[model samples]
Target: MASSTASQQPAQVWDESQCVAALAQLERLQAQIDDLRLTIPRVVAPLSPQITKRPELFAAFKKAAVGSQSNIKAFRTTWQSQETQALFEHTKASLEANSDLTPGAQLPRYGWEQKEIRDRDAEARRRDGAKDGEDKAVVSMSKEERERILQEFRAANGQLKVFSKDDDRDILIHFISGGLKYRFHVVVNSETNGGEHLDAECLGNGEPFVSITRCVSLRPHANELKPLLDMIAAYKNVQSNSCAKCGKLLDKSALVPTARRSKQPEEANEKQETVWEALHESCLD
Candidate 1:
């Protein structure tokens, strides 16, 4: 009975490889958490007087502060015992000795897979899941619903000059930010099945939009578009003030990055996603 019990105990599976990978991932993530804790509030605190005019923007900064606290809480749950590394080593040895394993046995899954691996899986799933659902949603949304959503967008920007000819199926929002008037259109259903953006002319009498591709937002409900508007302002800032490649206020050409677009890093979000900032064109290489 003693021998049988000892044999059964070794059956518990373990992988030192996963343990090692998890530690490496945690170290990288902890560095990001540290950076956010120190930098976010310092950067935004001076803007307190500015954002108060729009309470929602102030609230956003508060939300970010709470998120930083949450990341601190999460670190407490990482490796509960100091013996975790030693335990993983011991457990793996036992698992290796249990030579009774089958040739094609399935391994239990944990959500700690690397971000790139998960991204590939997510992309494949998104492609497979794509269909005419967005189009159908446009048909179902009522004019009343569209009006309510637009009203929420305008509530924060009283100077907004909103117009659209998409039969309540899309939106055109014109608002002032940084003392300059700018506008963008949202297609309730993107691709409009090959139609142009809700807006006719874009910045600088440019054609359509900042991007050649379609971008759409189908929200779960009507909410203030403060975040979206903030994104637009940040985009303008990068274009006019900073070099994306070097993250300097000005580049060698004495110009802000002419390029635009922001991508999330794998180390992003120990709590919530970090803000997307502007970039330089040649940095793409």
Candidate 2:
């Protein structure tokens, strides 16, 4: 009986090992099937007609895009118009507020006009009495005044000159209509960009008036000339090698005189010649 039992046990063990191997093989085959199922769809998807029909959809999308662009353009135009109107209204209000226009019969005095007249009267008085205290004032004045009174006054005191002397450059007084007044210093160089050279500051301001090509016919008149010259001289003396408009040291050679059509046609003539000038950036202050 013991021999029979030993033989049965070996048979049972062999059967268990075979069952385990068969189950492992079955699990591997199932895993392979699952992998195939996942890969087949990915490989065939690109070859399918449904996936390749994207070009047609894109064409329709482009047609719709045109309408969107038109809408954007219309919106931009409307916005720009509204902005312009607002700016115009604000400017008009500011002008009216500053103007001497009165609601009733009370005569309104223009503030700037009154100030200008007062300044002119004071200047006249100074000029009239200039020689009276000359002897007494000579010792009190600095060596700079002894060397050059007009030039020193312009340089130290920021007095604008309209024309250039041997020692001083010309000044340009900008009488902007619509209540804008400014001044600058300028020099005319006949050799620069076909007879054009401008102040370093004017070129740096990024304004319309800084181009040599534009200044071809712009010139200063008798009334405008002296003031412009004085302004330039004052700028030259005070600013020296710095940009008059920006107070930056700029390459003088890169500066080119530029001119633009004046905003006020009544202030300038058609045949005038424009030149370039420099100014203290602080003058704008």
Candidate 3:
């Protein structure tokens, strides 16, 4: 009976290669996890003034503020009388006016108008003090300022040509850059199309894709035309190196309008006027 039991018992075997392969796979998986941890982007806090400091605390505070508003609204709706509601609204308006933070707040609205008048007066003084009309209009602008203006124009027009008339609106100014002439148009009641006006094109150089483009807010500002003027001044006065895209040396003298019509008298009258500005011929597009 013992011999029969021994014959029936199976042999125990350990494969060294299988164990090594399993261990190798486990190590590889661990390394992949470690690499993933290092590559993942970390979450960042918002930089708004309200949340710049103690952003985590600000998140909690915002939640609590929202809850408080809900509670107040419920209480007002359930128990407050109509007269009380009117009084509450009036008090809220008064507080917002005093704070000068709310949109269309009385104090802020008037303050903005006053500020505009002051700025215009200051500009007029500076202009008068300058050597000539051209010098008077020369306002030093930063790259940021130029970008902001360009963006605003792009948002409205979807595409501004170097010197082509837009069928939709009136062209306000002709801008020249890199030997390319751009027409700036005034968009009346420019509305947001799916969060942006994305169709703006650069029709200068006859080819729309020659230059870099960007978008800005469609809302108008005081001295709405000044940014365009500033950009023209910058392009004319600032000496730049080779074309940003192609790295080719640009001739400043070669700058010309892209939309010059053939010598038909009627067409010539309608064609964009050629204006001299500093820009490279290849860069204008």
lDDT of each: 0.45, 0.36, 0.36
The better-scoring model by lDDT among 1 and 3 is: 1
Predicted structure with the largest lDDT when compared to the true one? 1
Residues 5-56 of candidate 1: C-alpha lDDT, one tens digit per residue:
3443544444544443554455545565666566566646746656666677
In candidate 2, stretches whose alpha carbon ends up further than 4 angstroms from where it belongs are: 1-85, 88-143, 146-285
TM-score list, all predictions = 0.30, 0.20, 0.19
Tens-place lDDT digits, model 3, residues 166-200: 33223354556557565534332233331111123
Best-fitting candidate, scored by TM-score? 1
lDDT of 1 at 249: 63
lDDT of 2 by residue, 28-122 (tens): 44444454454444444445465457786565455555545555555446435544344334434534445544432342222223223333444
Kindly report which residue pairs in candidate 1 clash with one another. Answer: 244-280
- In model 3, the worst 10-residue window by lDDT is 212-221
lDDT of 1: 0.45
Question: Candidate 1, which segments miss by more than 4 Å at Cα?
Answer: 1-145, 158-160, 165-167, 176-180, 186-201, 206-230, 233-245, 249-255, 258-276
lDDT of 3: 0.36
